[model samples]
Target chain A: MSSADFGALKHPFVLRALEPSDYRKGYLKLLEQLTKVGEISEEEFTARVEETRHLGDLHHAVVIEDVERLAIVASATLLVELKFIRKCGKAGHIEDVVVDSTVRGQHLGQRIVDHLTELAKQLGCYKVILDCTEANVPFYEKCGFGLKERQMARYFS
Target chain B: MSSADFGALKHPFVLRALEPSDYRKGYLKLLEQLTKVGEISEEEFTARVEETRHLGDLHHAVVIEDVERLAIVASATLLVELKFIRKCGKAGHIEDVVVDSTVRGQHLGQRIVDHLTELAKQLGCYKVILDCTEANVPFYEKCGFGLKERQMARYFS
Candidate 1:
């Protein structure tokens, strides 16, 4: 649905691909609403945006924008992976899913995840997957995601 | 190290970036040695290679080559992910880490992992991560990787 087509939205909002200008200021503002994020300089933000853009159609930065103030209210990323496996030989990873607390009950998160999942299928991903916190498990389940493996990670910092 | 730097070899082998020519015949041979994979037509193989190559430096396909047979015998992929996090602002994913069973225990797996880990650092990734089964955890730990998060997934078919 278009950002302006937010008839169900108490406020006007649209879901769309993140624009270049949105990264530095607008994105950080909406992102920090979900979690505490370290400050990123505008130059770094611009460079990183360009880098992700260069990742081609396999990567998508999707966000919901409030039309009135033109502010982002939610966001998620879809990363398609190439694999040497059966069928489609590709996989999709959904990450950084978040909705502004102010807009939580609107089911915006569900819509965003659903949108990305469809996009992954269109991209010929054999499967769509994600890792979420233990508390977020039920949320993903509600969005039609099934838990299969325990999420694991390693941080060098 | 250059592919030709096989001077330390007890057997004839080289490590190198996967060339487009390796996609169809050589890659499949090595991949099958790792696990059972479905057949991939030459057309599909070529198309996928071109698509992945278009992904630029964000993804790396590293392989071990059998000098005598002129074929890939072991392989790993390094994917760089842009993140809105601290430190380097990016993460690295190591996938498809496999060594040919015929050449098992030659330390080729360790060398390949080490190579990709270094590539991640150079790519400005704050951390390098992968998901492995319990049996393989010690192998990765031996290669200087430590367990951090419990792995999780939602596979669609």
Candidate 2:
């Protein structure tokens, strides 16, 4: 959905696509709460944003911005993979979902996930999946997702 | 790895990118071994292949073709997602991994997955992940992936 499509997002909060200007809005800073996000310059962030923009609907780096504070309070990305199964169906992989620590109780995580789920449905996705820790399963279950399988990973050194 | 970079495969078998002509090689039929594949016309398959082709390294749909049988015996896709984490790093999501039932015992699944893992590393991904059934846990563990988390999903009707 477009920024306009999200309607009024609790007054000062607006959900929208990651903009070039979000570099100054603590976008990367917010991500540090999730994982190891090292030093990222504005040029690097802008280049990546342009690359994602070129991908159109296939790459959505969505964010909830606090207009009053001029900071990114929550973020998530939905990467749609078109498949040969289910007659060329699409699958959505929700990644890097995080809500800033200070804004935890407002249900922004659910809101962002719900919005992206809607977007995935609109994009003709047959299923939307995500990998989360056991502690986060209850949160995701509350957001309409069910525990399906185990996630396996290999982290580079 | 490129088709050339994959070194040599077993006799009459070659690993490479999905081709436009693979529609005739039963690509969708091979995918059927994994999940439901509805009636997919050649036009639709070609369209999707072209779209994936345009994405270059971001979408790696590697396949193992049996020249003698003139069929695709195995298939998997590695989708590299550029992330804001790990200093603007990339992560690989391996999906729809399936080996033709007829070709299961030859270690084709491991070969395909290991190749993709190497490609992910070459692409500078900080990690590679996949969701699998409990029954398949040992297989992915054999491929050097450790059980990381639970996978959650929402399937659209």
Encode model 2's per-residue lDDT on B20-60: one tens digit a residue: 89999999888888989999889998999989888888999
Cα error, candidate 1, residue B70 (Å): 3.3
> Which DockQ values do the candidates obtain, in the order shown?
0.40, 0.91
Pick by lDDT: which candidate is best?
Answer: 2
Give the distance in Å from residue A5's predicted Cα in candidate 1 to where it truly belongs.
Answer: 12
iRMS, model 1 (angstroms): 3.0
How does each model score on lDDT? Answer: 0.74, 0.90
**Residue A142 deviation, candidate 2, in Å?**
0.9
Model 1: CA > 4 A from native:
A1-11, A23-25, A33-36, A150-152, B1-10, B23-26, B33-36, B150-157
Say which candidate scores most in DockQ.
Answer: 2
